[model samples]
Target chain A: MARLSYLKALQRALIDEMSRDESVFVLGEDIRVGVNNVTTGLLAKFGPQRVLDTPLSEQGFTSFATGAALAGMRPVIEFQIPSLLFLVFEQIANQAHKFSLMTGGQARVPVTYFVPGSGSKTGWAGQHSDHPYGLFAHVGVKTVVPATPADAYGLFVSAIREDDPVVIFAPAGSLGVRDDVDLETLSAVPLGVGTIHRPGSDVTVVAVGHHVQTALAVADQLEGEISVEVWDPRSLYPFDWSGLAESVNRTGRLVVIDDSNRHCGIAGEILATAAEQMRLTAPPRRVTRPSGAVLPFALALDLACQPDAEQLVTAVREVAKD
Target chain B: MEASLYRMVRLIRRFEERCVELVRSGDIIGGIHPYIGQEAIAAGVCAALRFDDIITSTHRGHGHVLAKGADPIRMLAELCGKVTGLNRGRGGSMHAADFSKGIFGANGIVGAGGAIATGAAWAFLRQGGGDKVAVSFFGDGAVSQGVLLEAMNLAALWKVPVLFVCENNGYATTLTVSESVAGTICGRASAFGIPSSTVDGMDAAVVFEAASAAVESARRGEGPAFLECLTYRFDAHHTWEHKARVRYRPAEEEVSGRLRDPVEIAGGRLDPAERESIDEAIEALLDEAVAFATTSPAPDPSTALDYLYGSAVLP
Candidate 1:
């Protein structure tokens, strides 16, 4: 067993995949020197051919990845910041994502978009601090946000292997997370499966990305009074709706803590799905950043905009009231 | 070579005209972006490419797709939105692709295919996939696009074998080159240190000669080359413009612009009897294509999202 940090797990996954398949390569800005650390040592191990250092051209490289995928290569693109996704949104969402269906299956864009420090950092300001996984989910692109180190490795593996475009967001908050993992036993986690981390029967707390840790902590704090079941939906687009239904049915209540904006977010969709389909004793609630949230540069202001433990505790408590 | 280029230009001309007719008759639902005057560019460029050479096209793409060796019957069926079409009717006019023939796709977004072609060229090189090069067919409007310029930079930097074909049909939708582009089109390639040239797009022989040199140089690993084919649009930008009456070109200008027709220019080189036979054969082939397209069934609505994933499962 070894202690693996989330960042380390990402690096290991890239190393393993590149070693396993000659078709697998990584491209990003300053990836050779590992500016984000996820691609650290990749240049030395895989050489410059496989570990390409692209210019600061998100649109160019994103679409470039798509093209390489079309030519039968598995390309993983590492974005240093989250908001850079917005710059390449058209390339990813429109061109790469649509190629399969648009070309009637003649093309398979097996490109993985890995955003290392997604969501708000301490004081990265507005441009660098946006978490837009919800946008990709809304557009039907396979979206995953792994909360733990093991999941980071497994999901990154699956994302690279997946024969479609997948955007995996490793939240800034989760970057520091370390987990005890048996290296030999670490394996791929299939997309669209949810795990109940700390199961209970009173209220089900659905958490996304880094918020899964927050939900687990909140569940622990509310353990004596409320039986809080924490469910981590690692993959957001092919959401494990059946698992969510089963949990909601068992607990009779639902609360979601998502890092996205409140309006039109994945949390809203989860709540609506539970209300429409699942058996719920009380109306569900969600904790999320405000609609159109732009994380300000100030330390406190940025923290204020992020979904936190206190908010999760309140949301879980509110859903448990009925 | 001359005869084949003439045949290709003629085929694209008639195929597009037939598509416009189908649109009028409601056989083809969405109107197509007619590649009427720009046929020689596709014919010339595609002729220069080998069977394995890849190409990524633009919205005005029927000519490119046809020139790249897609079955006209299947292409027509695609345009008609039939299950038997090239993309099983999912892609229609703007997104048709045949990977077997190395046609990457006909993209709906302008200037999007440049980077894609460059990347494909880079991968092909990495895979030791021989001297196969990639061609990206875009318009005068795409010259100003940052992505295309960035692609040129990457292609030049890595020495990726890519032929950047810019079909300068004078206008981008309703906006002319004077209104839409700044500086020069070939200057964009020159800025990236890519060798470039401007050629007459209406003459297939001229375009073929220029494209041959670029494709050959690229295949030799001499890096990328750019060709700016200056042509005119004889028909409406899109068939929708026919009804919208969005007139930007004057009557006199339109008359003069259509005079240097690619079909006529290519046909002038062919023996009169031989050209007549080729035209007759094309007419018969197109007749069969139209019949097959209209008769083929539309895709089942239940399978509307089929092939959305590589697994062929609707997620």
Candidate 2:
């Protein structure tokens, strides 16, 4: 068994994919120098041609990735901040995402947009703290948010290998997580699948990205009182709806804890879909940031707005009540 | 070179004129952003390109697509939103594309094609293929977009084989270049270390000479070049103005603008008899193109998401 940190897992995935395929290249600002550490050791191994450092032009490089994909190359673009996704939304949604269909299947934009530190990194204020996987999912771009080290490595590999454009959001909260894993067992995980971290009969707590750890901890704390099933949906867009339904069928209750804003958030989609299709004995609940939340600069203000373990525990209990 | 350039300009002129007639007759649902005056730029640049070379075009993009070797009938069908269109009716006039011919697409968003072109060029060079250069055609208005500037930097930094063809047609939707642009346009490229040249866009030969040098430079792996083609629009920004009559340029300016029609300039290079024959040939080609476009069936509504993803469905 080897200890693999979440950040190291991301690096391994990039190293593996770039080595495995000559068409795989990495591009972003400061990535050549490995400023974010996720692309560490890639430039030295693959050389400058494969690992490119781009200018501070998110829209330009993002669309450039689309063009590269059209020309028969797969590009993994790294974004230093999660909120930079807002700047290049048009490139991803309008250009890259629409290319396959718009060109009548003549093109496939297999560009993986990698956001190293997603979600609120306490005190980073409004512009830097957005978790926009929901936006990508809404636009039908394959969106993934991996909680554990193994899942991060596996999901990123899958995103890179996908035929369409994929956005992988690596939450800042989950980046520090380390896990004991057998190196031989680590492999590419299929997108649109849910992994039950811990199974229980009482309630199914659907969590995303960093919130999966919180759900698992809450499940552990209230072991006997409320048996909790922690479900992590690796990919957001082609979400494991069937797997979610199966979990809900067993538990008969659902609670989604997502970090995005409440209105039109992934949590809302999960709860609404569960209510409509699944056999939920009680009304589902969601724990998310308030609608249109702008994370303030102060530590307390930022923490106050973000969903935490206590909120997840309370939502789990609330869903179990009915 | 002169004969081909003349033929392309003449073909584009006749093609656009026929397109306008179709618009009046209610065939082309959305009237086009006519490329009547900017023909030389497309003809000159595309003449310098290899068949495998790629190009991304702008809103007024018929000339570029046609010059890049897309079938005129398919392009016209695209304007008419038919199944036989280059994009199968998914892309209308503003979005027409023939990827097989290396015309990535005709982007509706101003200044967006530059980045895509740069990316394509980079990819081509990275793949160890024959030095395939990409040409991005945009208007004076595109100079104002931040993405274009960013693309210039990326192209220059990476030494991507791309030609940034800026068709300086004086006005961006009635705003004159003098009023809108603060600093010089070519200086933007110069700042990024991209060698640039300004040429007489109305003279197809002059544009061809400049583009040939730039395209040659890119093919030899010398990096990107920017060509600022000084030209003017012979028609309105769009056909909607045919009735709206929004006045911007004075009558004198309009008279002077039409003085150097790209078609006439290029056609003058050929013998009188040869020019007449070319015109007749172009007319016949346009006639067949219109017939093909109009008779083609419109695309069905059900298969809207037909090409959304490359892989087959999971089930």
Q: What are the per-residue Cα lDDT tens digits for candidate 2 across B176-262?
A: 998889898998999999999999999888988899999999999899999999999999899999989999999999999999889
Best by lDDT: 1
Query: What fnat does each of the candidate structures reach?
Result: 0.72, 0.69
Q: Mind giving the per-residue lDDT tens digits that candidate 1 earns over B21-135?
A: 9999999988999999999999999999999999999999999999999999999999999999999999999999999999999999999999999999999999994999999
> Per-residue CA lDDT of candidate 2, range A1-322, in tens?
9999999999999999998999999999898778888887788899999998887999999999988989999999999999899999999998888877777677788999999999998878999999999999998888999999999999999999999999999999999999999989999999888899999999999999999999999999999899999999888988999999899999999999999999999999998889899998998899999999999999999998999999888888887788
Give, for candidate 2 chain A, the lowest lDDT window spanning 10 residues: A98-107
CAPRI grade, predicted model 1 = medium
Give the CA lDDT, 0 to 100, for residue A269 in model 2: 93
Q: Which stretches of candidate 2 lie over 4 Å from their true place?
A: B312-315
TM for every model, in the order presented, reads 0.99, 0.97
A1-322 per-residue lDDT for model 1 (tens digits): 8999999999889889999999999999999999888887888888999989998888998998888999999999999899899999999999999998888888999999999999887788989988899999999899999999999999999999999999999999999999889999889988999999898989999999888889888888987999989899899988899999999999999999998899999999999989999999998999999998988898988888888999888877787886
What fraction of the real A-B contacts shows up in model 1? Answer: 0.72
